[model samples]
Target: MKRTLISALVAGCVGLASFAAAAGTVVVNGSTTVLPAMQKISETFMAKHKDIQVSLSGGGSGHGIKSLMDKTTDVAMASRDMKPAEVENVKKNGGEAVRFTVAVDAIVPIVHPNNKVKDLSMQQIRDIYAGRITNWKDVGGADARITVVSRDSSSGTFETWEELVMKGERVQQRALLQASNGAVLQTVAKNPNAIGYVGLGYITKDIKGLTISGKAASAETALSREWPLARDLYLFTNGQPKGDTKTLIDYALSPEGQVSVKEVGFVPVPAKK
Candidate 1:
């Protein structure tokens, strides 16, 4: 619970004509999927700005929206956009919501390294998650139970699943609930019977990505909006930020932030040009 001051760590960039560290405290929450790169930005930004305090936390996008609505956090980092009703709820609760694009992410479907299934279409994935296709044999893999590791209800990844695959239906009672994307990746990587979806950043050597309808989940596809599962990552603020919140948001949208986006394995916005 040590407090970190932004200006103390981010002073060098003050005169760079990018983001001037304005004075004040800002709290950011949500998007554990993007936390690694976001945290990198926080460390670098804090080095250049000393007067502002920045606290970072993640409990998934749902936590981000909840904290914003309750007026507990100044910024919400989201792996996905807010749902329409969620936006309305924020306004009804006396909060103003504005979204800023921070980066791009893909929902990479993955399997254990040994699984022979290397490709799957979006429809096939949806069917698998919907309980309509219950075995790997049905998807051109081994004849296994096709145990699914899923982000818990509080996660934005789960929300994406509901919207894109489940089409608003509830998750089956048997879907294994994982606390975070990392956990899902870990579980799926270790369990041959497991299949899971994670953010592009979390797609690593431990688990192999499955091509979606012959297209791969990658930065190029994500930036071009070519991959059907690609999504724009976000930072949400309550109304317009005028101080440190604005500063951090500006830095995140700036070239430096986009570079960090790429460094952490996500597709940088604007294709890093």
Candidate 2:
């Protein structure tokens, strides 16, 4: 009886050890623009590291950074850099925020396929969102009021647009506000007169992308910085990541992960020499 009990105890201990060895979770939260690519990366990472799992969610860039600062998430995905106040806040809490550039992206202005306007100069786009140019005909389209769609203030995309396109101007108070790239795409795709923008990765055949200042938004243009709306995508951590978090961050900057970035329609980071 004693020998049988010892054997059963040893078997149970081995099972518990196996279960503990296979369990780890990495939580990532942030930008909707980065969500798709990260989702792909996470899937690949998990397959190779069967012991680790990645949990991802997108509430916007601000939320992601906030999650990191609050110690609720292992990583934060962002379409924009951390703000000055955000960095200061981290320092106050005895933590440092570190940013990792993950990909290059172009904020492509999208309109419905039926819209006749194929291109708009930078100033024209600014004017349209500023509510200074309200009619489509003013910009070479039909004689209809342009429905301006914009991302909300919390979005990193919105900050980039405000910097590059809005140019110190505000998106007119009446413009429709969306929470995610996909939402903006859908809003514009369904309305011929609507104009909106999204990360290059979110572009689909359903919406037509407008050229700005005669330059199309493409991987080549974005990487070359020839596209005026080009910007870098980022991942943020409380500090230099360690363990599972570091592994994921390193993979994202790895060649294979960069391929996933390109596959998802964003420009890959330039390879290191």
Candidate 3:
């Protein structure tokens, strides 16, 4: 059979994998970081199902979670784990929220491909974001004011960056706020002096990904726990999945589905027994 392109609209933690999904339309909302993988998976899944439709929206993980609480979606993708308060809220709203680890994601520190500097330590990354290192020259690059790009507060990716990179200091207000992973890539790709953080899937030939603490970003690195900046990609379904939802979730976790995850530039989980 001839191969065809697959698409997915994922809103959550994204891992590298080959795209795959089952028949039927599934509504997903959450992290923009994972959209590439989701979009790819949707394409793969839709190819098989022929009749099912997947609608994807990205307003951040918070938005996805809220949409789940409101019964507006079938699945919610999240970058960060659910807060204690959020879990309670889900229960209160009669949502049977289940967290599924779909893929592994490395937080990619990217710059315009033209930048000369390469690897950075975690401390150096922190220094850059905290404004302690203000110039590209300070980091062994061209003499330019370091322009910082970031996601809005709604982004789960931003939350993770805060916990891992910012080390709790507030991000400076001067940073440019982007709405999604795509936006961040576009910004960094077009601006010579810009630096921004995005998910592993978003890093491409158009942008350059930096090494952090000497760890390189890759599926092998992330899956083996060798990458310090990587996290598990999650799909949250309120309670036990039913009907097509259950089938789709199963397909997503299946070997075929997982392979597509890697194809779409995410880290695939080990095959389950």
Candidate 4:
């Protein structure tokens, strides 16, 4: 009887060890715009799949792409599609970048709540960032000089702004360069004369979102592509993802994962027909 009991105890211990070893870890690194949603999804995913671990980090979209190319991370989150050059570089390194669109977002221009300017035409916004419109009064606001706050070159937010708002023109040298959408939101929130832009998910009551070309930035408009600044948020994997990587990505695109997107202030991808 004693021998049988000891054998059963030893078998139980070995089974527990095997279960622990089966747990998988997935590393995701990328856009700050996508960071909040990813963090929430990771939390929810891990809660359900207790054996899986998900780690997330933000260093702008460009840095994430580089990490993927260097084979340091399992997934790369991006607010914009990989540029042609970036795709070529990844291919040259013997990796094919596959993109998955997870959500929709709008680059909403924001200002201090005190700023009276409510709406800006497309040309007016272009001129403001290009240094042509130096004062808020030029766009129907206060007489103070416009303190431009902008994202850094490495940011996908900045690239999207460059394409939609700047239109090949450059943001003025006078603009303040911030590293993330959170930084831009904070800077604009605190300074009454400052104007900046951020992902729709980053908008808060602390800063006022300015209407672009008479259209308000919202999930409805963004998902429908009616918002002029609307863009797709993405996750990139080298070739097709398998195992834990595929599991995480699949979860992110699932209905439950899409709920996390809406909870975090971004538009969920529509359900498949």
Error of 2 at 163 (Å): 0.4
Give candidate 4 regions above 4 Å deviation.
Answer: 1-23
Evaluated at residue 265, the lDDT of candidate 3 is: 79
Encode model 4's per-residue lDDT on 1-273: one tens digit a residue. Answer: 122322332342232211111249887887988887787788899999888887667778998888888877889999999989889988999989999999999999999999999999889988999999999887888899999999999899899999998999999999999987777887898999999999887877889999977899999999888899999999999889999989999999999999988887889999889
Give the per-residue Cα lDDT of candidate 3 at 89. Answer: 90
Tens digit of lDDT per residue, candidate 1, span 1-273? Answer: 001222222332233221122346667778777676677788778877877666766678888777787777788888788888888988898777899888888888889999999998877887788788898998888888989788998888788777876777676678899877777877897899888988887777788889988998788898787888778788998788767788898988888877877777877777344
Best by lDDT: 2
lDDT (C-alpha) at residue 137 in model 3: 96
Give the distance in Å from residue 140's predicted Cα in candidate 1 to where it truly belongs.
2.0
TM-scores for all candidates: the values are 0.86, 0.91, 0.89, 0.91
lDDT of 4: 0.85
- The clash count for each model shown is 16, 0, 33, 0
lDDT of 2 at 28: 84
TM-score, candidate number 1: 0.86
| Residues 78-158, model 3: lDDT tens digits | 888888888889999876679988888888899999999788888888888888898999889999999989888999999
Which pairs of residues collide in model 2?
Answer: none
